[model samples]
Target: MLKRIKPGQARLGMFIEAIEGSWADHPFWRNQFRLDRAKDVERLKSSHATAVIIDTDKGVDVALPIAMTERSSPHPRENLSLKRALRTIEQSKPLITEMFENARIGGTIPVSHAAQAVEHIAACMQDSGKALIEVTRLKARDEYTFLHSIAVSGLVVHLARAVGLDEKMIRDLGMGGLLHDIGKMRVPLKVLNKSAPLNDVEMGQVRLHPSHGYQLLAKQGDVPRVVLDICLHHHERIDGSGYPNGLFDKQISIAVRITSICDVYDALTSARAYKKAWNPRDAARLMLEQEGQFDRRLLMQLFHSLRL
Candidate 1:
């Protein structure tokens, strides 16, 4: 069983399943570990995490006051819906993380596993689509890269449905969103996570992610063509200004166009190590201001579907 407790309640011998807050604010690299050292406990207590999830089956459990315990419980129906969404994201993280790590090590892409994750995300969106997006937006910096994929997958699934795409295409597009940024795994972490502005050379390396991701997925024989197109051309703009291919309007596919909109929207709204998160309304407004960068009709559809 997993229990959420305040960091001050953490003690030696407990197994931490996760820390709830920005990973940038914590000293530990790994989220899960057995709390054995006193200094580690002190460090966690002093960290920015507001809550910690401990696996009682693996180690000790902490006792909470009656009021605190009661406060954790919400109205059952609402709680279940939100919990279902949150649980799906938590479960999907390791799967996505492992897949990316495997890619980094020159392993094959697990298309079946990734498809299953997309299915799970789609189901959660069915129950609480808005809640799922809300939960994903709170991602910790440490897990941002992996969770961003899941978030984009959910957005793609939502937007695909909004535009009345058939079920098969929706799933395919969702898969595309999940693996669209796989190329970033090949870039150096220093460049991906640098707090300062990237120089021209660093920017060039960052821009190569699409081609890198495209080549990596192209090697996977069974991957769908739509997924391949999205992985490579998502960065391309309709005005022929984007990179790698620089194709003009009509040269880009509808699926790629949608992924590009969601990709940029999520990046804008998400809090990165270098910048604070933008409000949804403000992010949407800013995206609208960027001329020729995205498909206007699709962007408006996304805005309406998300009710932003």
Candidate 2:
């Protein structure tokens, strides 16, 4: 999915050098990097190339080119425009360090480097059709709306595959998951990233997000009702203890129930200011201990389905 790029993230009129599918220690990637640096890597950087990523193969070259606009590259031959690449990056990331577990084997990732990583993932997804986007989700927190979208998408896709949803439903679930937290974009970053617990007033503002998200998507009218319902009802619970609408067992769709479990699990497992991630076993134990807070059957399904 595409999103609007924020300020300072775009680097126009640059020589963006992109490589694909060459693993480290592999002769091809090592040789290519050596040859390129020996020749003109400094020149490429000086040209202000937007982002560069070296991967394992060469048939795919999905650069968010300086002049393309299409988001879905469709086939390998098409060029991915920079705007679309920025859109995908903004739509699918928190930042490099948060998204991937071992992003920097040994050093700090500054703001500029983090931004470059987001751009690279977007370009790769648009260019290569690879969901290496998953790598970014490895250690993410609730940093931005896009981070939430990516997390929810992964969880939904994982659950959909386990439950045997067909291709269309699975895709729909992905789109829904991607936008489930769109409303949060309107919330203040200070509030969303609050260093301390929220008081009653701030908590109320947070609670309004689902209905707000529903309204935003409702205005667009492109997403189906099921997807919209998932956005709104994902916060609802099986035992009637959730918000936006405290939908109970018979009140919610099975899909919505499953999504809630997945969403909760992903959020909990992800590192955030308010909480640290629990180990997979510990997280499952906590969920199971909650009992009526979640749908028993679906929680069981989700617990067993985790890639961990």
Candidate 3:
């Protein structure tokens, strides 16, 4: 049997089935756990959370008076429709971190595993992209690189859906976004995390990441051409003024156009060591002014998709 009780009524032996609050508000990092410590119970009581659900099957149940009479309500985060998507993002982080570490060692990324991760994100995006986007904003400073990958993946999946692409193509684009900056693993950590602006030499090295990422993906060989194109050309411009290859107009593919817009959108809105994050609306507005730097038609589509 399951019972709900106020945090004040929680006991040490109770099996905490769920904490009725936001992840930030909860005393524990995870939703469910055994309330076996006096500190844990006290922590829950002191938190802003109003209630917790307990499973008698797993541990002690609350007293009948409170469990049977007093009502306890679960918070929205506990019952959110996008709960599974939030969980998926948590699960994907370590896997992606390992993939990047492997790449740093000259090992091939596990393509099959990456495809599965993309599919998981796409499924969640199809259901409630707003929740996933909200989840992305909660990432910490050290997690910027990996979570940025996830954010770009979510944004690309959202944009691809808005533009009416088929499921396979969307998954491929999500994969492209996920691995777009894989080459950054090759850049020195000092350069990647410097608090001050980069010198010209460091800036030049930073600019080489696209080609570095392109070459790394190329060596993998089995990566899809669309994915490769996005990895290589997402930084290129429309009016003949972008880098690595400086390819102009029709020279760029639709995949590159879409990925580039989504990539810049995530970067501009994400916090880094050197700059604070831009508000989504402000970031979109700034991108709109870049003129020939981005595809205007696609940018408008992205703005519409974001409901801006």
Q: How does each model score on lDDT?
A: 0.82, 0.52, 0.77
lDDT of 3 by residue, 119-157 (tens): 778877876566666556544555667777888888998
**Model 3 stretches with alpha carbons more than 4 Å out:** 1-79
Candidate 2 accuracy as TM-score = 0.58
Best by TM-score: 1
Better by TM-score, candidate 3 or 1: 1
RMSD of each: 8.7, 14.4, 10.3
Alpha-carbon shift of residue 34 in model 2 (angstroms): 23
Query: Over the stretch 134-190, how does candidate 2's per-residue lDDT look in tens digits?
Result: 322333233334454555665666667678787667666665665566556546667
Off by over 4 Å in 1: 1-75
| Tens-digit lDDT string for candidate 1 (1-308) | 89998886765457899998876876689978887555676688768887999987666556321112234444566556655765777667667877899878778878887888998998888867776776566545556778789889999999999999999999999999999999999898999989899999999999999998888888988888999999999999988999888989999999999999999998988778798778889999999998999999999999998888
Task: Tell me which of candidates 2 and 3 scores higher on TM-score.
Answer: 3
* Higher-scoring candidate on lDDT, 2 or 3: 3
Candidate 3, after superposition: displacement of residue 43 in Å?
A: 10
Per-candidate TM-score against the hidden true structure = 0.78, 0.58, 0.76
